[model samples]
Target: MKKVNIIYWSGTGNTEAMANAIAEGAKIDEVEVSLLAVNQASADHVVNSDVLALGCPSMGQEVLEEAEMEPFVESIESVVKGKKLALFGSYGWGDGEWMRNWVERMENCGAQLIDDEGLMANNEPDDEAITNCKELGEKLAKA
Candidate 1:
């Protein structure tokens, strides 16, 4: 079975909800899924997974959470090269510039993006957003 690990740092529970929905949607009979908060997810987890999903809400200045998510993302970059990756997040401000920049960085680092723009929700995710997140998960599971 393929193994997929979802690592996320969520503030205000918005991104966390997105992560959960993605996990639910990604499940497949031949796939195993593991979901972890940034603190619990180690660099090795990212390195070992067959497919990965990362999530974090936009923080001040439209950036990832500094204390955990940013550091976690950096730590996993080299290990994630050429890996199938998906990114999802929620933003309270800006026009998703953060996600655009993140996607560029992932591409530059040799990560294959599951979606062109990735996925983003403004603040709390509604039903449509949750469904999108789940679809993202299913895609990753197939990857």
Candidate 2:
């Protein structure tokens, strides 16, 4: 069975909602899905999963959450080469520069992103954003 681990950090519950919806969509006959907060996950989780979905809101200066998500991402940089990855998040302001930069960083590390631009919702995810996240999950499950 394929295992997918979704790790995320949400300051306003928006990204967490995205993660849960993704997990719901990823549940398939041959796939096992799990969700964990960034603080509760580790590099080993990323290493063992068939696909990894990461979520974090755009923090100051349009960057990743520095407290936990950023460090976790850095920890797995070497291991992500050739791995299938998916990224999603919620943003309160600015264009999705954070997700774009994040996607580029992962790709530069040789990680294959399921959605090249990743997924982003403004402030809070509306129904369409949630639906898109589920679709991204389905793609990740199939990847």
Candidate 3:
């Protein structure tokens, strides 16, 4: 079975809900899923997984959450090379420039992105957005 790791950071549970949905979808494909908060996840889990799903809501000035997620993401940089990755997050404002820049950064680092990008806005995730997140999980599992 394929193993997928979902590591996420949420300030108000928005991104965490999305992470849970993604994990649920991944299970539809019979893939083993490990869903963990950013602090709880380790680089070793990322290195061993077939797919890496990262979630972090937009923070000040449209950037990743500084305290935990940023450090977590940075820690996996060396191991992310050649890994299939999917980015997801919730944004309260801005034009999703953060997600765009993040995707570019991951690609530049030699991590293969599975799709365009995964983004949901505000505190609640719409059905369409949730479905998209699920589809992202399926895609990542296949990749």
- Model 1 C-alpha lDDT versus the unseen true structure: 0.90
Error of 1 at 100 (Å): 0.6
Question: How far off is model 1, as Cα RMSD?
Answer: 0.8
Tens digits of per-residue lDDT for model 2, 1-143: 99999999999899999999999889988999989999999999999999999999999899999989999999999999999999999998689999999999999999988888888988888999989988888988899
State each model's C-alpha RMSD to the native.
0.8, 0.7, 1.3
Best by lDDT: 2
Residue clash pairs of candidate 3:
none
Q: What TM-score number comes out for model 3? A: 0.94
Model 1 over residues 11-117: C-alpha lDDT tens digits?
78999999999999989899999999999989988888999999988887978889999988988778878999998899986899889989999999899898969
Residues forming the 10-long window of minimal summed lDDT in candidate 1: 72-81
Ranking by TM-score: 2, 1, 3
Model 1 TM-score (2 dp): 0.97
Q: By the lDDT metric, which is better: model 2 or model 3? A: 2
